[model samples]
Target: MSRTPSFEPYEGPAGGWGSARSLGNILRREGVPASGTLVLGRQNKVDGFQCVSCAWVKPAKPLPFEFCENGAKATAWEITSHRCEPAFFAKHTVSELLGWDDYHLEQVGRLTHPMRYDAASDKYVPVSWGKAVREIGQTLRALPDRRNVVFYSSGRTSNEASYLYGLFARLYGNNNLPDSSNMCHETTSVALPPAIGVPVGTVALDDFAKTDCILFFGQNPGSNSPRMLHPMQEAAERGVPIIAYNPLRERGLERFTNPQSPTEMLTHHETKLASQYHQVKAGGDLAALTGICLAVLEMEDHAKQARLPPVLDHDFIDTHTHGFGDFLGWLRTQGWAELERRSGLSRSAMTATAEVYARSKATIGIYGMGLTQHRAGVETVQMLVNLLLMRGNIGRDGAGICPVRGHSNVQGQRTVGITEKPELVPMDRLAKQYGFEPPRETGLNTVEACEKILAREVPAFIMLGGNFVRAIPDRGQMEPAWREIGLTVNIATKLNRSQLVPGRISYILPVLGRIEQDVQNGPQSTSMEDSTGCIHGSRGVRKPASPHLISETRLVCEIAEATLESNPLTPWKDWASDYRLIRKSIGETYPEIFFDYDQRMWEPGGFQRPLPARHREWKTENGKANFITPKGLAEDKDMPEPDEDALRLITLRSNDQFNTTVYGYTDRFRGIRGTRDVVLMNRSDIARLGLSEGDRIGLRTASKRDDVRRELGGLTVVPYDIPAGCIGAYYPEANVLLPIWHYAEGSKTPAAKSVPVHVYRGPAAA
Candidate 1:
């Protein structure tokens, strides 16, 4: 039933006519040709719902078409005319649906009603909301321990819903609340607080306009966050240097043509983005960053000896930072040979990059999962901070470290206390406000939760909005372990692999999407925090896909009310009816941050959360930004050197995909079409493995452990412009090869970016 993929080089600029055509095709295919256009026009507007895509901040001043190609796809995907009602589910068994791919599962369309899995029939049947809630509540209450339950959240959930979900978990008994952050930017959360006294980015959207230089490390703005290309284009036009480092030279960083620019579209002109591009090897970010920092130190030493101006910012260092002398000593001890070998970049390239950084008065460092999804993810982020600190890039206009977040409200979900660590949140304040003893013990994160599930320690799993089974690593183990649970509840907008792989007692509760009207007491609005720490309002304008759908806020409240004994102090019903009450509670709970949450939502640009680091006021225990030195040049010191036959594998997302959701088979930017089962390898590596361009290859995990043997086969080899020792494959599909235990040291984020594997010219071992 699948079409064979065709491979050819793509020679078009990103986001010009190609983007427009893709958007048109998606809109038409989704059956929202005209209506999708209207919906997209309102996205990111003052009164419009936020685009349910990336967390790129909206400009203070609006444009006619602020939405990008991926944004249009997300909106159309949500507001499509196709429906998956009870009748549709009744016709298909869960076994049958499990055979379908992710795209087809979602393409079947939005869920229409609450459905319960019927074990006897192996099908789903419509169930009344009242009965479903009551039974699920009773089942949860009957669990032996609250710790046996895991509550997972997605980035798409609104702040109001996320807050309530957190409250419900704490009130129920444990802090077993883990969200999407555990898999993506958990490294940013873990690494930044010690270095800069903040877990989020310090720079605002306006900083892009005034920045002297932009340094991108392991990020592709063109596909991950297309809206970011607009700012990069402006910076490029202004002649600001943009230096990029990644294993793959992403087209978004190479050249971009804004679809909104009529001049560019008519003239077929493209703006070159990255002034200098370095294809650093996979898992080489830490060494590469160290090399750059060492170059800066050398420049400073030379400047001091020659009586020229100093390159390093001593004033900022002396006043606001600690451990500089120790860090410098450790940094100088690192040899250039190791750095060059690990980074897959020449010393000249690193020195040149440092020269650009030293020349610029203000610089911005931007990164994504490529840096955060490695064993040394935390260390790599710290090294990046050290690089910025060398020139005093933090807390100044047009300068800061930016971690490009994936989901719209991923950062917001963390801000609202959707975390496994209770100490990170205000447990005392929550207990005082709600009249309940909140749990203080730590809970399970994504990796730990799966471990517990595999051991049969977990009894129930409740997801707010994500395809947990698909997105998490080690699908080979997780999918089967997930089915062994006692209860599984999925509150979502559409059918996904997670829903199909049901537990003993599973329920699929359909909820309203971001683009749909959420009316409770009156027309309501929810808030989301952007990647840049800006919290803004999002109001839906379109009709709901089905009348049976309920708002996430109401659903969370109903489930909480049904599960727990009536607590007048909590007032679940009152808060559910009016979201303003929830905001009031949030304001009271975190007065320092959300004191005037509702009033500020109507402001010209909403409101920016107070970032102490932005004011150079460190909030760490020592009240100073600290320079933490990593152990060695290698990001993952524990990872053994790969065999000569092994190559590092990096999982990637196609241009047509968002996270685990695949919209289509085509990866426009990468020149991949009609298939997701291909491996992109360097020409030299392809030849070294005795493989041709079109050879079907098998990849086996090079993990040291012998108990588990993971292998992926039947992948067509496509030569790419990547580092000689690395290969690329699409995510989720490649997740099977990744071990559940292989994760970042401090953050425990799955090390999906770098996995040692062996490539061969045949089928996989059974």
Candidate 2:
């Protein structure tokens, strides 16, 4: 291939990279030879630090070489030999660094000093730990109300850190802990609890081993979570039908060449995944899932009329569910035409999928952004729960609603009560455990937090770990919103857009990465939950990047103590001086599952948390899963009407990427190289527009802006394997196309995956 791609001088947002191959390509471009020593001590290990890439499920029985292509890159990115120490920062001012691309900044390597943005010279000057803490605390205190401050947590934060961070926020009299979840799976959180009592995934790792079939929707496991490909490969081998519902024909969904399969590798063979692949359009999952559920219910009726056993699990449904009659009535109202049209699938395809689902002894329906970024996002998830409930799939082995997460510890962060609205039970328990009155009032979510900052209603912001500005939609609004804050503190390991956007005073506190040593008051290990619901312990074999770098647990405790007037005990203070106390706090607050967390983490593989649904129990308010009837199909009014020159533009990830952090520019699977400017267009639509491959174009949103004429124009176009009426662009860049008001109903997550816009031949007039 063209000499492996490397980092270039990208002049876009901070903390962003587009392609995976860029790293190698950039290094080669810079004439930096690949460090052979850097590749050592990274392979052939189980029970090592987990991949910090996408939230893919890992192997329960750790394989000798279990990592995927993305996983290896994620690890290398974190543990690279390159270092951006204090000397490096001194060479360039914040403004000069800002001129560099996201890829260039990260490729320079790890941040070795705590730096604060000095606005005078527009440079990042080193600051003492004492000054950093006091600055942040003073800003929080200066806020009109504690509610003015927001604590945004990334999925990369350890469970111990998340717990301490939430406790600090609550003790400080606010619950505005808008996490990454609000952007990805808030639909599951808001809708699932109402329908099934649990807002998270109901299936466990063991459930995958037991289930007869796996039904995947709106999720691309290959790029999102390559680790899941293994379990899928296993299920496929066991004769379990693995069905995929997606708009694009994903290679990850097709046959996979297992890097760990020695036999297959030698023979140059591969295993086929996704026995059945259905190409559903954007926002078509609800119709597809609804059709399948309705067909299953109809087949049951036919079987009963024929004096055969009902296709539905009537016994399980009778005992553990409500609203069956209403669901049946609603099913009758949705005709085959609506199902076929909405789902972009033929009626026969729907019938065939329903047949496979009915024949299976148990099934698990897994989904992600595809379903969550729609106007009917919440209802779509509820319907999936209903589908599982009808088959008694949930509370049974291997069958239930599994909302896959994007970040590694994102779900666990929520589980530890990192939320805008903390549950009463968890809050009361936290107060009792920490000797402080936790906040009862609901706080601001992501969208609301940005609004507060924009309105000058918020004075300060502290992010645990995440590229908040780039990650959040409406970058136009978000960039200016940061300036309104009196102080902004980001507890991060590296520099990103969040670091560059300054308040009156801004501090970027360097912290330890997950793969680094986490030394506390005493010897202890931290644990996290994999996307597939497996809890595992993580211990770093490598030393901390710097002795100056502290664990997130220590940093949060210090800040909480500095900012709080209530004399809240520094939970991580004593714990940092030992990690066992942190584990004890986790066990105390969530004893049911985290019981003996300290001891359990030490156990070889770590212990699994109890998923009641795995045993066929519904935790809904009614003590049963209720089948929800969706209101009706809704369209993206943002798109120009059918006759208008509008095509839906959805954002996607390259194999080398994980969320906003791009490892490289080239997409190996898509055959695109050396560019993030390429847009994946439907072949037919591009042909109709008289556009060819590699054509430079501008993409304008159908919904014009009233305040500013902002549009995601001037992008390169490339025909990809995607459906008609659909186009694809990378996030944060495409984020400009997503208006602040354009969000999923109820969940408030921007429809980053599905946007409608018009394509032009060249850049719009600037």
Query: Ten-residue segment with the worst summed lDDT in candidate 1?
Result: 634-643
Candidate 1 achieves a global lDDT of 0.91
After superposition, the stretches of candidate 2 with alpha carbons farther than 4 Å from their true spots are: 1-47, 58-60, 520-524, 566-572, 635-644, 704-708, 764-766
TM-scores for the candidates = 0.99, 0.92
Per-residue lDDT value at 19 in model 1: 95
lDDT of 2 by residue, 1-766 (tens): 1234322222221111222233345434433325412332332233456556666565545666556556656666676667767777678787677666667667777777888877887777888999888877776766666666788899888888888888788877888899898888888888887687766787766778888988888887767877677778888888889888888877777767665566755565667778899988777788888888888878988998999988888897788778988888988889989888777788888788899999998898899898898767888888888887787787766777788888888877777778897663487777777677777787888888877876877777888988888787777676776776787888887777778778888888888887776766444467677765666677775677687888888888888877877444554468667766777878888889888776665454446667665565667677777878878755554444433377777778876578877777656666665767667878798888899876889877667434444476667777777878788887757777777767778888777766767777776531
RMSD (CA, angstroms), candidate 2: 4.5
Off by over 4 Å in 1: 637-639, 763-766
Clashes of 1: 0
Best TM-score among the predictions, by candidate number = 1
lDDT of candidate 1 over 603-632, digit per residue (tens): 655688889998999999899999999977
